[model samples]
Target: MNYLDRKYQATMSVHQLSILLQYSNQDVFQLGNFVPLTALSLPTIIRAAKALVETGFLISNEKDLTELSVLTLNTSFNSKRINVKVALPQSSKPQEKEAEATCNTLMQDRKYYMECTIVRIMKARKVMKHNLLVEEVLKQTQSRFFPDVQFIKKNIEALIDKLYIQRTDQNDEYEYIS
Candidate 1:
């Protein structure tokens, strides 16, 4: 069998063991519990349980496995093994481009938001000083996000370039082009 098939089988064995433990009324697993709660055949449960016991994730009383034999979960071993697995990096796929795309999209969205906020404030106020506009933008957008002054200034320049607003004689004040 391939490595992936073996891994899948091992994962399924662990999954089945967990389901059995969760459904069983008593701390120990019994044949009667498996028969009523799950559609899995008796042979399948026995095989998985035996595999779990061999892997130190389960304990069984019988030297010879059987449907009637009781089994217990080995929680410490399970936790230790899980911790070891978590400590190991699972970087099977390359993710750098995905992360870069996400970051680029976020930056574009933020820039759009800043531009919209500047336009909205200018439209409402008709004319506003640069410092006041920046403060108002910060106050209005703070709940959604805290924007940097430089980014806000950049958006303000973009709005001017788009002819949505214009700088007044004072240079610090902006007049909405309406």
Candidate 2:
């Protein structure tokens, strides 16, 4: 299993947590079945440390030189790790409301197009390598929309130009782009 799965399954005792916070050597000590703290396993330590902070036990003295040194050493050991920080974007109330409205409109339009018959046909034939002959594609289109072949062809061409479908030749066999 991955680190995330292991973390989810972790259940440490209060004594183990206290050891981690109180002893300097505890920085490298094994806690339960956790992996040893090393260059390759630093993220696990960082995650556990953050969990301690979340539970109000691991307070940092941001202005302390010793704290800065520890942080610098930890960062150097885990150079490739990423820390996820989520923050809401700063925007005026009206601008935030407008953005939400625009997102809703786009989502609704996407849902409408997904239910359209033409989209279904395109989705069904997404893996064809060559252009499907007009006659062959028309038979499938007929079952869905009952439109004339020419009309279906025009609609297919428009969809292709709009990047919804990919057409490889003069004939109408098409594939969905997504």
RMSD for all candidates, in order, please: 12.5, 15.2
Candidate 2 per-residue lDDT, tens place, 59-157, comes to: 533432121223211211221223322122233776789899999997555434432546666677664543344445556545544445565556666
lDDT string, candidate 1, 1-178, tens digits: 1211122223444436444455345556775457556667776566666666666556887876687888776544533232222111223343677688899999999899888989999999999999999999999889888999998999999999999999999989999998
Model 1 clash pairs are none
Q: Which whole-number lDDT from 0 to 100 does residue 115 have in model 1?
A: 89
For TM-score, the strongest prediction is 1
Candidate 2 lands at a TM-score of 0.27
Local distance difference test, per candidate?
A: 0.71, 0.45
User: What's the residue-level lDDT of 139 in candidate 1?
Assistant: 95
Error of 2 at 31 (Å): 94
Worst 10 residues of 1 by lDDT: 1-10
Candidate 1's displacement at residue 63, Å, is 37
